[model samples]
Target: MNSSLSLEDFIASEKASLSEAMQMIDKNTHGIVFISDEKGVLIASLTDGDVRRYLLSGGAMNCRAIEAANNAPKSALSQKEAKKIFHKRDYVVIPIVDKKGRIVDIYTGDPKEQKLFRESLNVPVVINAGGKGSRLYPLTKVLPKPLIPVGDLPILELIMKSYLYNGCADFHIIVNYKKDLIKTYFRENEAHYNIRWYDENEPLGTGGGLSLLKKEIHETFFFANCDVLLDSNYAEILKFHKEHHNVITMVCAYKNFNIPYGVVEIGKDGVIQEMKEKPLISYLTNTGIYVVEPEVLDDIQDNISIGFPDIIEYERSKGRRTAVYPVRGNDWMDMGQFPELEKMRVRLSSE
Candidate 1:
């Protein structure tokens, strides 16, 4: 459990034989300690799993453990870069190298490195999962859209995980269509979340659902759609919203478009000024995520289907500040249809 395994000692030298590599692993529980050469150059690594996999792959115990290293990711600019790429995959382990691509160190991405310190937190979160998901068609016939599975978990689970990863846990799920299925699923599972449900009773537009929570909330909380997933720093977004003193903060993802056919730029009448083929364009789009203050909730009429945006428009009329946080397209996904579901499944499985 040594989180500080140094790569300088575990890596074998260029001339060192396989026998020396085995001794190093034996001393450090087989690659838990970082491996590096005498000149402090990183070369290759052996992990406990590597040993197991090697043996399972028909490798004998006598075989040099160094041979198990699958071309260690070489670090060029810095050691951290190599660590990130190598650890991004299964059995996170890393090899650090210099500008010359010679291994400078070895690292194991300990799970502890991913831990986040809990700060003084008090904000609540509202998740809008009430949609009937008519876009999903036949699939929605039997299950609520939020309850629909994406990979081994539901789309909603991934959404919550993204939020939870940033240390925001309080939640309120808005439900209406197939409320039983939503309730039943949560009841049967052992999820340690402080959650409450607000039923719309009838179909409500996205903005209208937040209107139902006026009575239960009074502070700032993030409002998110269950159908979309966004990987972002919630705490940073909340801080930006507060520092900017904005009433509403929208999280947007930048999407790029490239037209395959020639595109023309014309002026006034029908004169073509110029033409560009496969031009790349970018746009900031609604990511279905938001940071809202409690004051906006008060504008909703009791039991009304008015959603959060309705309040945004109302407040905007009074010159309220509305802002947006832009993220990369890779950080967001919308799975409201069969085609998108297929894409999501493939993407998740690949990850």
Candidate 2:
């Protein structure tokens, strides 16, 4: 059983808002929280997956947490029973409830036994590594952006390993800027990665390069930029894409910004309708990662500079499905610029 967190940290009131439960889940880093009634009786359990599903179904964030929770969550009477349940099922956490139906403790199994629980997805990965990386100017002058080291490993290697962990081995890399250096680096490295290289004669935008591989990839695959790292479950993302029957699913991160001053809204007659101080706003930002279907590549024009978002819009115009998968803000990291490079290095090193 995990003891690092207090019982209160694992429990939320039934009347708490969904957003508050989400914040608690994020703080615990366990992706779950237990909901209790006013008398401290267990009512339901909520996870990040549940919240995501609720949001995708058009549920409001201000709704009660119980509205999006599982009312019949599994519970155990003892830690030993919880351990057995953990081994028998795929559950990560179990609540220990007393005869009165109040939660006494939580069981998370042994720390060492907490491995990544994901079904192996042996899919192909396409990496866009041809960018000039003008933001990292001086470093890009000496070494290709893909070759820049985050810790001991290059950024490209880190990106590959993330997919490889989810059982993806086949890689198709499109290179143009400093292509020779990138190719040579992989050639010299001892780690055997199943990578195929493609070259572009002229500078092609992110989506345009996909035209080069028009008929090569016949199945669904993951496409991502070289400089961004998403600390998320790749298998879950793939599952969402396939289950929703979407042609393209863009991975987006929720970023929250706080205003420094009071904000006021005016009415038609110059009357102040509403005023608030230092409001926090949340929005989703694209993380340069996507789950794409093979046929989408056929829509790209050869040698045309078009962004991936433009391709999504074009597909949407044709009545094809395109959607977004939301992830937490800290789960997405970008090393495209100098300051973010150092931050990425620190984040990866601590891991």
Candidate 3:
């Protein structure tokens, strides 16, 4: 057990805003924060999952921190008891409180403990690797985008290994551009990947390729673009998709942009309705990662060019259930462009 973090870092006031608690959780890197009264008596525990669920349920971020917290959190009276509780359950961190219910220290297990506690989701993954990466230019001229190295491993390999870590071994890869090199590289690699390759005779836009897997995929699976990587919990995403009974779950990332200059809202006939100085704008962006149902693929026409977003819209128009699962802005990484490629490289290398 590690108690290196100061108590203040782990404890948030009961009166604190949900945004403040979220910031504290991000700073702690433990994915949780303790809500305590002014006297430091623990009242509840808030986790990243809690915040996500709160937002999904339409709770406002400006609300009190305790509003999104688990009021009945498991706590221990001593370090020994905390350790036992931590080992016996999936608790990421446990708070040790005095007889008066005042928190003294927190028991955060080893750094690697987080990985050990991740629940495995044995699902199939479909990757769209057929794009002719125009943005990548010269690099694409020589190598496929998926074959480009992020660190020591190819980006496609990194994407596969991520799913592999979560117990997903079945990979259905759709390849077209520079297909020979992609196949040869995997053929020679030492790692034995259970991949089912599908070739597109003509260029098929992102969603078009799914038609090839119409008969193959009979259950829920992951559909992703080759140039993006997501750090969110796949198991939790799957759970949300299943619980909501959604035909498609688009994994979106929260992107925040700050306007450097003052912004004005215009009403009728050049009338200014509202004005703010240097406002911050936040929105959820599609990360090109999705938890998809097999039935959706049946609607995709074969040998046709269509984007995934269009497919989503077509499904939505038909009154099908489609939802969005949001993740932090930094959790989604795109290597489709030059600058982002370098950023992804640095990010993966550091990891």
Backbone atom clashes (below 3 Å) for every candidate: 11, 0, 0
lDDT score, candidate 3: 0.88
TM-score, every prediction: 0.68, 0.89, 0.86
Q: Report the C-alpha lDDT of model 2 over 42-153, residue by residue, as the tens digit.
A: 9899987887788789886668889999999899988899888977786868899998989998887776676664457899999999999999998899998999999999
Each prediction's Cα lDDT score? 0.69, 0.88, 0.88
Give the CA lDDT, 0 to 100, for residue 330 in model 1: 58
What lDDT tens digits, residue by residue, belong to model 1 across residues 1-351? 244445445566545433444445544433333345566555655544454345436665445545666446334345566556655653344555666555655555555655454343457878998888999988898888998899988887777767777777888999888988888887877776678999887777787787778778888888888888875456767877899898899887645566788999999898999999976554567878899888887766766666666677888898989977755455667897788788788878965
What are the per-residue Cα lDDT tens digits for candidate 3 across 168-233?
889999999999999999999999899999999998898899999988999999999999988778
How far off is model 2, as Cα RMSD? 2.5
Question: Stretches of candidate 3 above 4 Å error?
Answer: 1-9, 13-16, 37-41, 97-104, 111-120, 257-280
Which residue pairs collide, candidate 2? none
lDDT of 1: 0.69
Error of 2 at 230 (Å): 2.3
